[model samples]
Target: MLPLALAPLRRLFLGLALLLPAAGCSSGGGSGADDAVEAANAQNAQKIGAADVTEKQEADARFLVKATSNALLEVELGKLAQARATAPAVRAHGAALLQSRLDLLAALRALADAKKLAIPPALGEDEQEAYHEVSAQTGSQLDKHLMALLVKTQNQDEDAFDDMKDDAYDGDIRGLAAKYYQPIKAQLDAAEEAADAAEKLP
Candidate 1:
């Protein structure tokens, strides 16, 4: 019923009206897609952060456990040598070693506590066996045994600290190793000296 010109104008307006709703829908969908992409990225970042934390915690825990065990063994053996050795040099060395181990253990405990880790309450089976074997000896025999054990253990401790100082994943763990490696090396030197002295004994 409309005139020819009006008919074209009405068709054009109807076409524009139809396209407007579709365009609005397309814009909203684009915004939603962007939001989804952002959320996924944030989620992935959170997972990566958690993984990194877990890895560092695991590394730190391993170092703490091993260091604690070593400290405990050294403390026990130092006390034994202090009580049983006939040589004044051996006894003095034991006292000094005991004090050093105690200090190291105290620091390790504080660090472990802050990390929410539980330290082993006693020595391991192998350590206990070693302690008993040393306990069975007396006099020069005990001195020889103790010095040998100290030399071996001090070397191991020095090596462990050296590795951790260089390779630990956690900054704090690396710092701890760096702080103690020199002292451990010094202990190793003392142990070697004690062993030499023990070898000279009749």
Candidate 2:
């Protein structure tokens, strides 16, 4: 026999009593959904970081492959130029390329080792075909084309290295790029001069 107003007040008090345990669970020893969500976010962040490192390693590996391909092509082309070019400067440039190969290979290998990356041992098919085409030529046939190829390839490499030097994800690769850029620039200059000289030849 409660009063009409007393009935709603009793119901309201009962509802509050029922809600108290839930409020305590949130504030007390229970690890609520907030903690679970935060933990999940932390784990996801860790996964993302790991994924980023994997991507960076892959890019560094690609860099090594490209460098090795260019180096091998340069060495092979240099030998052909040395043997067949009629121009003395082209032959000397070929000799210089061959000499530079040793230093370049060592530097590339060191970078690969430091990064735990495997260096590719051979050139791609297009480059091998280009190598054979150059190898089959002799005298003036080899001179201008070889010089042109040198200018093209060396300039392309310089361009790539310039673009990559600052953006390398690995600090070591960045350092290597910075260190090598100057030498590659010098090489590119020589290749340009050789190309210009060949064009000027009588």
Candidate 3:
């Protein structure tokens, strides 16, 4: 199982302005596990709070970089999975997943820029253009898919959620999620590495 290393980082991100709105989403909610995740995340943040503001900001930025990358990676993997989905409904769901990725990347970009985090050179031009192109197309596709999911989940269509969940995980969703998230994480990880090697940036 993937560790919940991202949890405390998620809540420290609550103060990040960019992540505040989405924090309400709780996976496996109403379960003891969900409660534990939240509590654990909160406690982790409090523990890390002993650090000075500058240190906190740096840590927050590092967390943002990793989380944002992971999210985008998941979306890209979803797009690939969508291409293989035999069911139109499932494919549409995949499109929505891709759109979500674009939204996440956009948010992360905004947050990183806001925090003055340095952009990696590789993502300078070509990567950005591809992101824009994919984002535009995927956004349109996701709108259609989400509308369909709404109908399906409402019982207008039988067994939609089950189908979607199955399709989402069919082809190594975990692996793909990790693969896509790596680039962004690597960049942030590099920044952290640099920070560690040098005096803290002003």
Query: Model 3 over residues 1-202: C-alpha lDDT tens digits?
Result: 3235434433443454342222222332254333422333343344346333444444443344344434443455356436543344445545655665576566555644543332221221222333344444343353333333223222311222223223332223223334444433433343233223222212
TM-scores vs. true structure, each candidate: 0.71, 0.69, 0.32
Better of 1 and 2 by lDDT: 1
| Per-residue alpha-carbon lDDT of candidate 2 for residues 32-86, written as tens digits (9 for 90 to 100) | 3323223322332333333324454455556766776678778877887777777
TM-score of predicted structure 1: 0.71
Model 3: residues with Cα > 4 Å off, grouped in runs: 1-55, 87-89, 119-202
Candidate 1, 1-202: lDDT as tens digits: 5555334333433433333321111111233333322332233233333432445445555667667767888899899888989887788889999999999999887865543444554565566667788889988889999889888888888988998898775566688899999999988998888888877888
Clashing pairs in 3: none
Clashes of 1: 0
- lDDT of model number 2: 0.64
Best by lDDT: 1
Question: TM-score of model 2 relative to the true fold?
Answer: 0.69
